[model samples]
Every structure is written in C-alpha cells, then in structure tokens.
Target: MSNTKLVINYHITEKCNYDCQFCFAKWENPNEIHAKRGLSEQLIDQLASYYIGSGLQSTKVRLNFAGGEPLMLGKRFIEIVSYAKQQGFELSLITNGHYLTTQFIEQHSHYFSIIGISYDSQDLNTQRKIGRIDRKNNQLTPTELARRIKLIRHISPNTEIKVNTVVNALNWQENFTPLLDVITPKKWKVLKVLPVKNDLLTISNQQFEHFVMAHQSIAAMSAEDNDSMTQSYLMINPQGLFYQNQIHGSDYLYSPPIIEHGVEHCLSQIEFDLNKFANRYIKTINNSHFLTTNTNIEVNHV
Candidate 1:
C-alpha cells in the first residue's frame, strides 16, 4: 500500500499582477507569459480522473492552487474546488492576499480547508533589499493586510489561515518577533526563507543561520505555549520548477518536476521519508551532526 499522502499543487498561471521584488515564483516580465485564465472544465475533469485512478480515489489527497496568484485564475478556482469536493478531496490554496477582497472570500470560503497569504512590509528599503514584495504593486499596507486576514476569518471561521513570511538578511532576526505578535492568537503559520539558486535573491550562510535560529526559537515557543497556534506546512512544486522542496527554495531558480505519465510519476520518486527530509533540511542547518549520522531510522526503500 502506498502510505504517502498525495498532495497535488497546481500552478494555474505564471502571470502576476504585482511585481514583488522577492517573489519566489520569479515572474519575469509578467507580460511574457499570457495569464492563462481558468482551465477549461474538461482539463479539470481529466486532472480529477487522473488523480482518482492513481489510487488517490479514497485518500484525503490535498488540492493546492498556487501561482503568480492562484486567485487571479478567478472562477476556474471555484470550479476546480467544486469538482475536487465532488471527488471527496480536501482543498487548499496559496495566495499573495493582494488580490483578496471581501467578495472573493465570501464566494469561496466554504470550499477550502485553508487559505495561505504571503505578506511583506512596504518599507522599500527593506523590500528592495530582500526582493519579497513588488516595489510598484506592493500596495497593500500592513493595516490593510490585517483587515484582509480578519475578513477571511469572518467569512470562513473553519478555514485555517497560514501566513508565509520569507525571513531574509534584513528582517530574519529583528522583524520575526514583531511579525509573530501580529500572527499569534490567530490562525497563522510562518515559513522560513529558503533560497532558489541563480535567482535575483540568494541565501548565504549567514542568512541561513539567522533563519535557522528564528525557526528554532519559534518552534520552542510553539512547544511551551501549547496554544502557540503556530505550524509549519509544505507546498511542493509538483513540477519541481520552484524549490527542491517547494517551501524551501526560490521559484525563479528551482526546476519543477516533469509530469510525463502523470503527477505520481514524480511523487513516486520522492523518498517520502518526512523524518529523513527534516533531518536533511532542518537539522543539517543547525550543524547537529548526530541526526545526520543516525541513519537508523527505518523507512521503506521503495
């Protein structure tokens, strides 16, 4: 039996309205790639069938929508979610929250189990250095961001909220606690900044150290409070076009997996060993050589 949970992360379109400096998706001249609007209902059905036929039929496979901004796909997202539910799959979507409006939230709140929003501040000096937010389109203020988050909660109380923050040289240490103050006591999650090689932004050893320290600190807080209300989640680029692990690296530099026979063709190749992966990604950074050498953790090779 394939015990691995099937998480399908789809990049609907590469075009983004905002030109955030540090956008991992690395939207290069958004004009180059025509924003492919909602996928035809037919392709949606085919995708559904492919997943179901590949033993994802009964599993609580997650459907995640990502992109320049997934919500930008508009009605296609709703259609896909409806179809996924009809097949009994859970749903999730990651967005910049720049396009998030009350009307958009109201229309699709019930369909998703969670909605992830990415926000970095408007301080141009801070934004330009890290390249996380578009200089021009980085219009949403922190107050506006807080308001949008509030509306999402009000519209869909059950839908968990996750905030993806990329910790870089400038804000990794100083801004973390402040960002936490904003997220805690609410449903939110923060992702450590992972680098994509050759992208406009690269992660150096120093930045990595700061990020690891921040993660360790937050992880400890989450442990002590019990009600820490913070969690870490993964969004793998099925195509491997982004990060080696979607959540860790830069979108511009990473290569998404090639889906030839189907999506599982790529999924089956992954070790699917969460512990080992964590040891490699999370532990290796801490310079804790113990876990690195302790390969005794048993996992099915195949």
Candidate 2:
C-alpha cells in the first residue's frame, strides 16, 4: 500500500449528451458545483490542502475528473483540470470521447497524467442499444477512437491512455482485443455494469467472467466485478459532496457538501474502507505496464 496513490474521482457534472441506461452519474441535484467556479475552486483547495498540503508524505493524490461526460463542459473542464495541475495534483479525466477533439488534445493533453475513454462495444448496433450514441445518432467508431488515441500519444507522449468498458447484457460477449491491439491503451478497465438505476443492462457474473477470460491475452487488461467495486473508491458527486455506493442497493450514500463541511468532517460521514481502496489500486499499480515492463500481469481497479 505504500506505493498506492490516493485517487479522487470528482464527477464534475451529471449532464451528458449520451444517456446510457447503466450510467451511474446521477446526483439529482440541479445545483452542481461546476457551474459555480468559486465554489468549485474552494472545494479543490480544500482537497489540495488536506490531501497534498497536510504532510501525507506517503500518499500522492490523483484527481480524476469524471462525469456523465466531463468533456461536455468544454473549456471550463480544461480550466478546472489546469487549476488542479497548478495546485500540484496529478490529474486525469474519464470521458465518453464524443467531444475529445484533436485541437483540444494537442493543447490540453499535457494537463493530465492519464486520459480514460469509455468505449463499450465495437459494433454500432450494440452501441446504439446501449445508448452510447449522441443526439445525432453519431457513435464513436473504433477507427475514430484509435485516431484520437494516436493524436493524444503524439501530442503528449507522457500522458497515458486508458479505455473503460462496461460489460453489460449488450456487449458482454463482444471481443475487444482487435481494437485494443490497435490503440494499445496503458490500461483497459473492464467493469461489470452496476444496476444503479436499472438492471436492464446488467450482465450475469458468469457472463462478466467470460468476457474477462476471453481477453486474457491483453497485457493491460483489468476487470472489476460488483463486489470489488463497493467501498473501494473515494468519489465526489457534482454537488461537491462525498458519496459511496451501497454494496447491495442502487441508492448512494452521500456526505454534506465539502464546501460547507470541510474535507475531514465530510470524509468521516462516508464509508470509505482504506484497506479496500488500497487492495483495489495496489494491484493496478503493480500490474500496470505503463508503470512497469511486466506485460504478463493482470489486475483490477474499482
């Protein structure tokens, strides 16, 4: 656990162009903090002060911006991540890749240590069924995805690329090896779709395992079943509150706003298992080919 980095997944906005059925970025609060720059900066300062400035010598903090689509925030998203970088926090972003333009990548890719794109299925019909298509029915094809990855790699060679796939009833049997071989992501995070809103897209445990086993040859591949996902992450919702998913329920438990109640008090309100968090990322840190030369290792990230 000594080498484990503290990851803070800050879901800056719940608004998304594509409405995936299994999407879990629902906070229901219309008053999101990202719209209020002052409040958002205040929250970031609190996080920086406690996690980085508070003399936690053993821990390095990574601020990962996530959302229904963080890229939808456009320039404001870049502004927030830039501020985080300025504060000496390692940064990352998880987006659906619809708005990841080449120009943006060329200019702002340097702000992140990593950029994770959600790519569920290679088949267009499956992607459409999963609601991963945008308003114009435009889906991010594998060719375009690979192009974006190449651009990111060329623009900022040090910025690691990651692909996140949610194994659902629609895409569980699809093999991603062909596309993954082309992009060669630093990591391919395969996750079981949590029935947070509905079980319509959820897949069976056996089906999930089948997908992981099928992709065993990918050196950067990792899988996280629902059990390993629970209480294994430190997440902040769009409202600047600490939130955690219940192991058995669709509902999420949340703390009071971090802007209102400080980081220490707010963290105490949530159920964050340090051991689970460590176990979740330690394996990733160990098996990551981006961090090491070992290509035979496989791990999980919650």
Best by TM-score: 2
Per-residue lDDT, model 2, residue 177, is 88
Residue lDDT tens for model 2, 151-227: 99999999999999999999988989899899999888888898886788887777777787788788888677787
- Pairs of colliding residues, candidate 2: none
lDDT of each: 0.51, 0.85
Off by over 4 Å in 1: 1-5, 26-58, 122-124, 128-138, 185-193, 197-199, 211-260, 264-302
Superposition error at 66 for model 1 (Å): 0.8
- The Cα error of candidate 1 at residue 77, in Å, is 3.0
In Å, residue 275's CA in model 2 sits off its true spot by 1.5
| Residue 115 Cα positional deviation in candidate 2, in Å, after optimal superposition | 0.4
Model 1 Cα lDDT, one tens digit per residue, 1-302: 14445555666566566665545554444331123433333334445666565664536467777776777667766766687678666887778776788888888877888787766444546655554455463655666777877787788888877666654446655555555566542333433344443444434544534444444534322111101111112333323322233333323223333333433454444424344323322322323221101223221100
Model 2's TM-score against the true structure? 0.93
**Candidate No. with top lDDT:** 2
Q: What is the lDDT of candidate 1?
A: 0.51
